[model samples]
Target chain A: MKEFKVLMVDDEEDFVRTLDERMQMRNVDTSVALSGEEAMKKLEEDPPDVLLVDLKMPGMDGMEVLRRAREAYPGVQVVMLTGHGSEADEAEARRLGVFDYLRKPVPLDQLMRTLKAAYKKKIEQAMVAASFAEEGDFESAREIMTGNTKKK
Target chain B: MNESLFMGKVTAAMTHEIKNVLAIIRESAGLAQDLLAMAGDSGFAHKEKFLRVMDKIDKQVERGAEIVTRLNTFAHVPDHEIRREDLSSVLDEMLILSHKLSRLSGVNFTVGKGSTSVVLEADPMKTRMTIYRLLEFLTPLVGKGSEIQLKAMKNSHGLPSLGLIIKTASLENFCIDGILADPEWNSLEMEFGSENAAIEPSPERDSFVIHFV
Candidate 1:
């Protein structure tokens, strides 16, 4: 099986580092970005299958990152994990197409399940897009990849 | 800026910080547990003890998280001047907030079960403050090992009301007339009057009911 890749973004160094270590131990390929700016840079250079981001951050909060990521890299799934997120924030995240919104201090098993589900979604979308491309439906394939497929 | 709003803003910020602190502690302790599980019979003599301590830490983190969440919600009470709020939920939150005071006085605060929902449109901050003050006054009077069960109901005029049912081991010694006659009771009446509410002794005299307009 291909390695499941996840990029975690948070301002707290200790938290992100510990989470990274735990994910790695669970056979996940995990990368950490301490700030939203760093996360954007990492996404551009090496986009992962899923982005696990914290809502509150120093420079460029998670909402902006979610917006930019959805626009530029629609293929990558994004999940929000925050310690102090409000209902409004969750609503905004859902509006921006976030895969899931989870509270901080979540059990490792729950986090793992969410990440795996996100990765599976990414793969499923990619396969459908690939099928469209093979059939010479470039526009449909683009729509599938960008998550803008028109409803019948 | 309104004084209540300013205080609420500061409190909300502090609650956020506290939540972050708890998250870090939870993750750090969790990491230790993860490492221990991965160790797998490395002959660590204190493994069981460490696990037990970690369990305690996890439980505390859960407790702290709940408190911070409630405090955060309470801090936002001043955001609105008058809002429609469920009487039962308001009483529930105030009961949780008064846990320390109850412990200090050796009293237990509970919300009566199977109570019908009573929604009221009033100043959120003032409503909560009135409830807190009432609990504060009654906690000491009821003395140790007493129970104060709050119930939401309709008054004789069909107005929303909250009934404080006091139960103590020495019920014979508890005097509602004495409390009603105390000088502080007059002050409490004024406070309740300011909110357009009235506190009166129940027919049974074992409880007090606050009638809301």
Candidate 2:
């Protein structure tokens, strides 16, 4: 659990940075980005297995990130971090294939728990892909490629 | 896209959750009040814990209401892209967003003596969003219950440049690198360009200033 790379994005620089510090204390590798754009740069430079992104921001806010994550990296599990938890927002995040939605001010324990769970999902996804490879199901493996969780 | 939307959704969702927390506080506070009156009539033995719970509920409910209001203002009037909207009005709305935040963040704000409102032709929605973004950054630096004064008035040269000065002891310690990394920050900086607005730390005061031209 410790040393897992995580990207935490929030317009609230203090909040995100503070959370980053806490994650570090817990032995998790964390990076902080104040805005969505910054997060994208970091994401491109090095894609973390899990991204914890704030829901509100100016110009390019969180939803935009969700929409882009699918096309960009496809493998990282994104957890929507928000101060305001709305039904529409949850539905929207789920629709975008977000791993989960967590509201802030986040308790240290709750966030860590979420990170662990999100990491589990990522592992499951990896295992599923590996199985497809062994079975010689190239089409199925292709379907399971990273962010393509929308099994329609 | 996901980043921007994620931030917005989280704020929106937190608003609702905060509302629920407020609802409980309100109900508990109201119940305690009713009990206090009833107890008074019966002369019931004092339960110190009851009083403490009542006080705690009162405080949390107040805080919760403020957070709800901030969310409301942010949600209700985003992107008012018309003629230059009144910075005072826009700021006042944003204040509600900060209301629950001020007490703890230790953010102090004050309008300048020369403060006055002037008209500028800009997109209302974008301007509001820019300030909103700035506050999001500022709130964390100040201790909780701290005051953030918002003064909107015109600047010299007849251009309506709204002034935002964030104050607090920790303001100096606040992280700035991340703010610059934000896309919205870039958007505002790009929108205003180098020629117009000024965003910098004041040498004389513990403040971060933003001038909207």
Candidate 3:
């Protein structure tokens, strides 16, 4: 099994750093980005298997980050972790294809399980896309990686 | 800008900040616990005590987080001028928000076990304000060690209504006639009337019912 990679994006320096250490203690490869802009730059440099993002931030809030990530790196699963998101925000996030929505102050065990599930989903999608590519189905492989199936 | 909307906006923003602060506290405490667990039992003294204190911090964080979330929801009440809301839920939020008043007056507010859901279509802000005002009026009148049980029910006209069942420590000290005569009572009645609602003592004289029309 490859090392599970996650990029946690939030403006709260103390919170994200502490969480990053906890994830590392659990043997997961984790990195922290203080802002959405930093997160985007990191995604370009090295995309993680899963993107753990906060919905409310100072600049380029979580939804915009989720949108741009899905557009630029469709293979990476994005999970939304927010403290003050409203129902409307959750609906919008779901519409934009969030892997999971979790509230803040979440139990560590629960968060770990969610992250594992998200990472598993990302791997499964990649494996299926690779299988299609092996059969010379480049279009289907692209569709699988992008999570977009043909209309007909 | 409307006063209520302005207040709501400010409150919503502050609650978000409070939530972030709580999240940081929670994560920091969790990391401390994680480090302690990884260090094993050999190196650290009072490991059990430290773990116990961390557990307390975790519980307090949970409690604070719940209160902040409720307050954030309350802050958004002014977002809609009029909407359909369950009376029971509205009363529940009011009880939580009025904890300070409850402590000051030594009156506990709770929903009656037999309470039913009664959805009302009206101004959400006005509805909450009406309940808060009633609580303010009744808290001092009922005195200490009293309980105000809110129940949702349909009125004689089949309209949704709230019944405030006042259980005072001393029934002899509770005089409905005297309370109705107070100048504040008259003002409350006028306020209720303006909102297309009416408040009057129940037939038993021990409770007040607000009928919404």
Candidate 4:
């Protein structure tokens, strides 16, 4: 199996195609969704370890996608990629439970590092949930998997 | 708040779209390069040439993206009513935005280095429009193949000023006084006056100065 799976959501087809190729070259399993709605669909069909979504897109935007994805699939980590960065937008994305927010033309090394860290976090969460499930504490395991701790 | 500002907002949004387009182009070219590298010896016969072409595409995408980004900033200039700004950067942006118009008039605009950065307290939208109007007024009078040099400086009174020095032959025929007296100049003067600014004919007939106090 691939090291990790990532879903890239953007309206830019060429960007997705190229970035998808680059991620694949780095040994990451990457999928592309052209719109926010399509991204939500992809999440339901095959939830990945991480999601890299563009902030501005037709039909639905990155923020909405992040909000819905976190609500529906709590296991997936989302990183917002935006061409336009503003304090409010970044704050809003963070409040919506994005793992990280990055600007466009992100250097490959930096992006890779972020992806690796996020993927690691996902793995750790799964391991913790597995431990709880093994103890037959299924509800607590589900809570841990969904990041529903009262402190959070 | 005004029509120009509304249009600027719309144009700014469009420029963002253009940036996205450039980003996609860059990515596509990058992907092509990646595939070429992966292909190894089995890749297309003209490997070196193909790589060079990709490099060219990447460079052009960068250039396009930079312009879009600048245009986006220009589009947002009207968002504020008045603010402190570096006049040189403002001039550079307006020159870029009006590049096509200058080309149509067969005029080229260049910015000359000033002793120091001239920061101004003014309405950015009106300031740009004022400079554009000056260019519009002079481009035709200066004739085709003319060059205009601009500089940002503090005037004799130490007020922030923009200097437009026309570099063309036969300034005798193109009288600054007569042009300044025209109705178009009056309208431009009124526009600047609305923003509590003034456009004055420089002591030398070769140029004009915009003063923002």
Per-model DockQ: 0.61, 0.03, 0.71, 0.35
Relative to the true structure, candidate 3 has a C-alpha RMSD (angstroms) of: 2.2
Kindly list the per-residue Cα lDDT of model 4 for residues A1-152, writing each as its tens digit. 68899999998887787899888998999999999999998999999999999998989999999989988888899999878756688999888888999876655668889999999988998899999899998888778767776543
lDDT of 1 at A85: 87
Query: Model-by-model lDDT, in order?
Result: 0.88, 0.66, 0.89, 0.84
By DockQ: ranked, best first = 3, 1, 4, 2
Backbone clash numbers for all candidates listed: 0, 60, 0, 0
List model 3 lDDT by residue over B1-213, tens digit each: 798889989999999888888888988999999888888889888999999999999999998988898899888999998889888888878878898899999999998744456899888888888889989998999999999998887898878888999998989999989989999989988987666588878988999888887
Ranking by lDDT: 3, 1, 4, 2
DockQ of 2: 0.03
Pairs that collide in candidate 4 are none
Candidate 3: pairs in clash: none
lDDT digits (tens) for residues A1-152 of candidate 2 = 66588998877665565566556766788888888899899999999989998777877889898778766776688999776556788998898889889755444567789998888887887788889889997667656755554565
Model 3 regions lying over 4 Å from their true place: A1-3, A136-138, A150-152, B113-116
Residue-by-residue lDDT tens digits, candidate 1, A103-131:
87677789999999999999999999999
lDDT of 4 by residue, B68-146 (tens): 7778788778789898999998888887888888889988999988979789998787788788878888888888877
Q: Give the TM-score of candidate 4.
A: 0.69
> What is model 2's C-alpha RMSD?
18.9
- For residue A44, model 3's alpha carbon misses the true position, in angstroms, by 1.8
Candidate 4 residue B96 Cα shift, in angstroms, is 1.8
